[model samples]
Target: MPSIHKNIFTIAVVAFLFRLLMFFFVFEHSERTIRPDTPSYVRPAINMTEGHGFSGNEHPPFFPSAIRTPIYPVFIAFFYTVFERDVLIIAFVQIFIDTLTAVLIYIWGRRLFSESAARLGGLIYSLSVEQAVHAVFILTESLFTLFFLWAIIAVSCYREHCRLRWLVSGGILIGIAILIRPIALFFPLIGLLFIWMASPNMRWQFMRHGIIFLLIIAGIVVPWVIRNYLTLGLLKVSSISSYNLLFYNAASLSTDLHRISQAQARAAINDQVTKELTALGWKGDELHSAQLYTAWSRKILFSAPIRYVYIHLKNDINCFLPDVTDFLELIGATQGGKETLSVLNQHGLIAAVNHYFDDNIWLLWAVFPFIALLGVTYLGTILGISIQILQKHWDSLRLLFLPAAYLTLLPGAAATPRFRVPAMPYICLLAGIGIAKSIQCYKIRQQQRTPI
Candidate 1:
């Protein structure tokens, strides 16, 4: 194998080892503590494994829940039947998933960018503390990242090969991704934009392939939509989206009005939203309430278009700075078996991360660089992609899905570092390319400056 491939393997190994070590040490605090709460994903897994038919019939059991899609829980249940809920073993699997994501980044970078950029992107993703941090959790992000990256890779393959089969495969992977995280439901639509742009002249060609992609995606997703319609009497895949919008709208309004600090105002808004849902056949149904509240959210968003723009921009910028306190709490939940969200009542995410590493030079050294890179990459990706569009280069345009994904997922409750993790591989790619371009320019300048 070439040195680059060998280095990629080494990064993957180190990522696995680093995650394992963190799970045993920093995450768990060296001893297991009794879990304070059970997550929603666990019940469906247990139910599915015990022949309950993919239902979330535990911890406020809902018969035929349309609140969430079943893929991640089914994922857990599959392993549970074999390993019997070994947390360490689960973490081991996450390590593998995370490593695979890094390898995919390398492939994506090489295919869409230069070999050097690909190596840099892969290395950054492999060693990413933020990405690895979530690996030990039982949440959907780790597995979601895996399928999401592969989908991107498969899409890249379709573009390069121009094969209808590859296009369908990409759509299928996206279907699976939405099953894991419903927020991804609209992600497939991006293909439409890419397809038209790639072959603006060959309208017939792009439309034919695009229809195949969408039809395959619909084939994968329509069944779940039908299940939801049959069970919940709603023509939707999941109701969580409405709740997500409500939280986003509520948070943005509270922030914009400076009402989050006022307990009565927050409660009043939440209560008012709840009542609005109740009026719309919610009947104390969380799922239906989510759908109803979403309507209210859109109404509010449209009512104040300028404010909505400001809110969107604010949340977009905030996506880069993830909440450390919430993340540490997430770590406590995963490793220490404690679940709490009280830290959210405190301060900004940047301050929280800084406070966590207070006076720890060793950790600060590692963490600061990561933060710096995230900021730089966020800026670099924006500038680089904008340049590409202006120059009319369409080769790497599909990667816009990263920013699109980020923006789509951004309008919820609040932004956190974890929320930003999924898009980082692409950010790293653009930043890697940016760095390579800068070095080349510097070399050219130096050569010109040489005295003859």
Candidate 2:
């Protein structure tokens, strides 16, 4: 085994080099194309700087023009203040964060498993095309993942030593991460449950710790609610409108449907669909320009809730499935998306080879089978560890399991590969233990077989 510092440094170098190569060579041309939410963030941050009250769409004051939390944009704006609003620089910063996340994954894995497993996990994560692609785009997923990983690290620290301050620190990180992305609100509560389940005899102690944890979380969140109230005159906690929109429009016609001008019946249906949302409480410039995106979403839900559920599930699955061809075109390896198939035909052999590899990267989903194998191994390790804890009656392991289970189960309903990435270190750690245990058993059997 290598020294811990050496292992970390090696992983960092490899991860950084991989990400830097992708940032410079691959996404160089693609970064200019504004991502889905880029304008929303840039415009609102510009508005905020201009001293305008938060007047973004269906979202609360917290998100403003951006559908995401404000922290990452604020960080981006700080860079813009210094370096000018070069999308390249912003993209580079995101790449750096993505690399940092890889480092964190390695460190967390090392603690949970062994150095080799940590290195492997970090390398796989660093080279992941999905992570690399997303990193180049200006979006919340990369930044949100950084904070999410930090929260997990904080939880691991708290598990190692029962310190109130560590618990509070973990709570605050979870709080900020949730603010960044509302779905994270489940973390601290999950942590608390893990703690309680781990500590049966220390019930009173756990309760006190939980109370302090909640207070720390509330301290961070309550002020944001206050700001939202002052700005919007609404008593909402965080941004509820986005969720409403997602819930409502989870099954609407594709935004591209408007392009088919010859289909008068389809166009009429689209117009009626547009009007249906405005007829609801959806108002304001954002809704008007965006055509009551959330309101329209809600209308879809109201019309057929069950159908919407099915559609969202299908979409989530599709998000995970390999779309190598589309992704290749997205990264400019193919001439498919912008040009007709006839035009692509004119490009000849070299271009065809590029297109073939680009379009087929979705085959990487094949890795999911290996990941699932690791997951099963991790489960067995967890069970074995749980048995040990039960025999020893170790409360800390029990506490750790609570948060671990929460993080695992919460995302199962909407499982995308990226969504699953944040949990990879934990999974890898468990898998590493399983591997280590098998080796130990093998060595023991060989020792028993030796005859004099």
Specify the highest-lDDT model's number: 1
Candidate 2 lands at a TM-score of 0.70
- For model 2, what is the alpha-carbon lDDT of residue 390? 54
* Residue-wise C-alpha lDDT for candidate 1, range 1-452, written one tens digit per residue: 98767867876777677666557643444223112212567777787777777666664454777666788877778789999675555666877888888877777778777787677767766766677777776677788877877776777777677787788888888899888887677777776666666655676887888888888888988999998887778788888777656565554655566634424434666888767766766666655676677777787667777776776665555556633433344345322112112122335544544445545435444446656756666666665576567766666855644544654355544555666777777776776676666667789999999998
Q: Where is model 2 more than 4 Å wrong at Cα?
A: 30-33, 49-66, 237-273, 276-282, 285-330, 335-418, 428-452
Tell me the RMSD of model 2 versus the true structure. Answer: 7.7
- Candidate 2 residues 1-452, lDDT tens each? 55877767776777677667656654558553355457756655555554553434334544433244566657667776678667777778888788888888778777755666566656666655556666766666678778877876776676667777888887788778777666677677767776666546876887888888889888987777667656544444544444435422332322223322213423454576556655864444332424344555565456666654554454343233332333354456543333222122235435543555457545446445544554554465575465446556344344334444544444322333445444444444444444555566789999999995
Q: Cα deviation in Å at residue 118, candidate 2?
A: 2.8
Residue 448 miss distance in model 1 (angstroms): 6.5
* lDDT scores in order: 0.66, 0.57
Task: Please give the range of 10 consecutive residues that has the lowest summed lDDT in model 1.
Answer: 334-343
Model 1 residue 155 lDDT score: 72
TM-score of each: 0.83, 0.70
lDDT for model 1 comes to 0.66
